[model samples]
Target: MFSTFARIRTLYSSTTFTNNTSIFRCIKTIAPSIDQCSNPFSGKGSCGRSVPNDDYFATIHHVSNIVRRDIYLERTLNKMHISRIVNSELVYRVLRSCCQHGIESFRFFNWARTQHPQYDPTTVEFEELLKTLARTAHWETMWKVVQQMKAQNIPISPSIVSFIIEHYGKRGLIDQAVELFNRLKNFGCSQTTEVYNAMLFALCEVKNFQGAYALIRRMIRKGTVPDKLTYSILVNGWCSAGKMREAQEFLEEMSRKGFNPPVRGRDLLIDGLLSAGYLESAKGLVRKMTKEGFVPDVGTFNSLAEAVCKTGEIDFCIDLFNDVCRLGLCPDTETYKIVITAAAKAGRIDEAFQILHRSIEAGHRPFPSLYAPILKAFFRRGQFDDAFSFFSDMKVKGHPPNRPLYTMLIKMCCRGGRFVEASNYLVEMTELNLLPMSRSFDTVTDGLKNCGKHDLAKRIEQLEISVKGI
Candidate 1:
């Protein structure tokens, strides 16, 4: 038997053994039958992408479970024929799936490299394992992985470095983050726009505004073009610290230097304020924009409206909606959905109806989600007649109720003690070839029997048995 587990020990002997002894022991124990390994998921479409079959997923689940739970993983895995099917994508996915079991994941990663030449790991696999190690704070092992990457002559990208830096900053290891940022060249990665943005984010996380500002200036002086994200990071940072005026100044200064953001400066400021929970400031900015006839980006308007609506300011959102529309801002379906949902929740049904009509007039088809909340509001107000009429109207207008809608209607009917209506809807669902939930059947039948509608209860029970084939 060409055992993968037996070869893993030799592979480790040839490589540096900086990892713990237990990981080595785990590696030595894995014995896969690589001679019989075959690529069952070798089918490909015209695009040349591997189309994985069910066996691929089963193998993935099997291997991940073994890595996660099996005490003798090598012995268990050695019996499986998985060597040829192992690729970088599979390795990345398995690593991601074993997210909480970092050490075991490492053991599996090491074991995988010894499976076959076909299972040679790539940069994707390395990056994923590095992320797993970093996220689990396995620093020594992470650096050893970096050395392995170096030994393989794979140049580390700035993006992965930035990821590590961000994690370092999050853990308040700012010094480590700065040190890594300073050593980009040693890792053979250029200090690109993405790396600079990440460093700025880290600096701002610790409220080091002055250092962040200097870093951006250094980035610019070094002739690296600042992307929109670079500007947003600083602006958002300032707003988060309640320094709106400084944020505005930074934007203005950047604009003067010919680095205007892709969007309007005020839009960024308002969005930053909203993100920072300075709702009143964000609202104040919107009010100013409304008066100045400046049409904020529809996205900015949507964010502002949605944030305010969450605070029970639907009336204000309504007014803001009208003002922005008058200013020639075309609201997307999401904008209307936000206002309608907020209005419905606040019992402003008429307002919600008006918005829905407008949305329909604008050629937006009313989906179930777009209209379900209105039905819920009507039910809450005990307007059973109106709710039923509205549902019928929606059906007539070409929006057929889905299974979930029927299920919801049935549930609501049962809750309201309208057993007759519930039975009627249950029958309608069967006629439409929709299978009502077992719980729905039980609830309606129980409610019907309690209301002395014994025949209807028997009919519902028969329908349940017929649909479920029980």
Candidate 2:
């Protein structure tokens, strides 16, 4: 029996550990007869010292446990394609079992080196395993696995390089992404537009505009013409750095060469000017947009409105808002939110309320974003009557409270000692089939005690008990 496994292992090495089908057949037979050695090779290689029938029975029983676990965990859960919520310990258990049983585990390095394409070292499905590992944020484990593959001199593909760059970028590890990129280039992975774009986008995210700009120039110097999206990434980086003038120059350069860049280039120019308090400069560009038959989109209007509003020039914002409407454009909820928010910030609460009301009457719905500054302003000025009334109106209009809304309302009620009112709202919540959640209960419980309503607090506690079962 020991001689048989040694021959099998020899056959395995010669075939690069291929699934010959004959090997599994031999294992299926010999595994049940393995009374020979629990410690294969006396403690080292193939088979150990002689043992009895009960020892074989015990080993077979242990193999049963291992096989059962792998079938349920790695084979089943892994086959289901859901890695996140799946118990990682269970996978480790199954892998441990396989490794101990001299089996080729999923965790093993030479998993797919075989004659069959499906079991090939360079197969696409094998690559999917790496992709899944990278995507699931198992970077360390994946790095080790890829390195082991490298130790065997497997050809690392372009898509794998792209995968690494994207994984680091999405995880917001810019330096790690750049490091991986450098490593890829060092390994002679020819740079593609896709690779350059990934690195440029990552730099843009970290506000490393100058670095991204320098890389674009370097790529051009290397005769690797950056794509249109690469240019857009640089423009976005420039907008982040408040260098609207350079962005505009790039845009002009693209236009002169007949390269059609994104419409968002103009939008970024507007944002940079608006953010830097250059209202007139921003407006001049907007006018030029219309002059060039480039209808300013919703984003252009938003920046214009925000810039005008920042100057406490609501009148100009209103004019700009009308222009946006005149162009038959629907402003996003964020744009309307900014209008009211800036007004409320400037203590023009009345104007803010008027805009909010007009927005609603004009077929615009209340967005949760607009409520923050408006809520803070109203609460600061002791305008709960209006605030709670607006709250009621929002619900009646079929808009539900978001997390921030509930948090703000709870705080306001607690500060104002409105326990009775808070408890009443819970009743309303119950009526609407909305359970008073943890936050509600927290507010009410604290509010009642703070207000010296110990009896009411007891009742609220009882109500909590009644609802817990639900």
Candidate 3:
């Protein structure tokens, strides 16, 4: 909801902002009244005379844990190290404070870094701050830190080493992140799960199928059993790669390894198959679940039915409805909706009527969603009378049609040259607060245009524009 552009522009434009002012601005913006804390750092006594590094860290450990921005501000105010406060401590405190709270601290920390450009970049403490800032998604600050670090000796943590790589990896910085990975490797810190997951996720991100697969193999060899999350990543990556076969195989392998993959796995496979126009194949996968010693529950059927209908398989879904009855599985509301959708799509008016009748006989109460298919079914058959009748039924059931249902019915009425009925729904759209979208309005306007009703169209256009302002 926030614009990073505004913040970045503010950073680049500002000058003469010293660390104190920069930090104050940050605290003001992020910590909000951090200066008002009763325990504010009385900078004089907060710092000590010629303090050793370990003692400093030990004494301030409690301070470091202070998550309240007000407390941090109080500490910041009083804890100016007399020994020329190192850049690392500066960055780390700001970062630790932010991490304890949120990314809001970046504003203060970011302002702090830029205001002091002439500060030694190679100072070990400075490098630590830069790395922490980057880890918190501060890319603008990260690059500045990296350039300065390269210009001198700044020892980045092995964790920051990996984090820097990932920062680049996410923004498609594969080559640069790899270079940093190599640099960190020379320091004897090997790739860990976070490292591999970062690379795998990155490669999977841009569909670098071959590279991600190679990393998967490397991860397994290093004794990293792919977590359920990892498997899900691989599945989606495989689908994006147009290698459904591999996704299916990977799912089987995960199952064999005793990873009771989430129902989402089945969802992915069925959805992928349906999208590829493999309705029969999708059904086969669903059927196979039962044979694999996992009982196909209502959810399983619902997912497959929805997938089948979504992929434009109306007849197949209708057949599934009858088949489900024979299998003694009582269809739920979702199942009925799926079957009705298929009937509507296939324009099987008689079949849709039969299904609707059967749903009533079988005690399936109609919901608003059920109207999507039934309304579409009537519209497909050019039955404006029947469509309105069902629309009335929805109101009686205390489930008035929503925007989508309204749009569908309006389109049907307009296409069949029923401008009067279409206008009724346009008013209904306003009364229900379901502002018809641009496309929905277009459908109505087109109908009104054909019927030569400019005045009515203008009214709808006004409603649409007014809602956009809101």
82: Cα error in model 1, Å: 5.6
**Which candidate comes out best when scored by lDDT?**
1
TM-score attained by model 2: 0.51
For every model shown, what is its TM-score relative to the native structure?
0.81, 0.51, 0.46
Clashes of each: 6, 3, 7
Residues 1-470, model 3: lDDT tens digits: 11323322322222321222221111222221222222223353333324443444443443344433453453453443211332334445545544534334434444445544433333444545555565556667666655666556554455666556656766786776656655655544567766666667667767777777777777778786666556656666676556888888877776776655655577666655655556676698766754554434566577777876777876766776676666666777777777876786788867877877777788776767775777776777777788778778666753556777777777778788886577666556665566666676778777777778876667666655555543
Clashing pairs in model 3? Answer: 26-108, 40-74, 41-74, 41-78, 43-78, 88-125, 88-126
Please give, for residues 210-270, the per-residue lDDT of candidate 2 as tens digits.
Answer: 7877787677677776665687667756766777778888777756756555555677676
Query: Best to worst by lDDT, what's the order?
Result: 1, 2, 3
Writing each residue's lDDT as its tens digit, candidate 1 over 1-470 gives 12323422232123221222221122222423333233322342211223223444556777899999998887787777555456665677789898777788888898888765667677878988888887887777889999999999998888888888887877778888899999888889999999999899999899899999999999989999998789888889999998988999999999999988889999999889988999999999889988988999989988998899888887899888888888998889889888888889989899899989988998888888788889889888888889988988888773778899889898888788887787777776766767778899899989989999887687677667666656
lDDT of each: 0.80, 0.61, 0.60
- Screening candidate 1 with a backbone cut-off below 3 angstroms (N, C-alpha, C), the clashing residue pairs are 5-30, 5-31, 29-74, 30-74, 31-78, 32-78
- Residue 466 of candidate 1: its Cα lDDT? 64
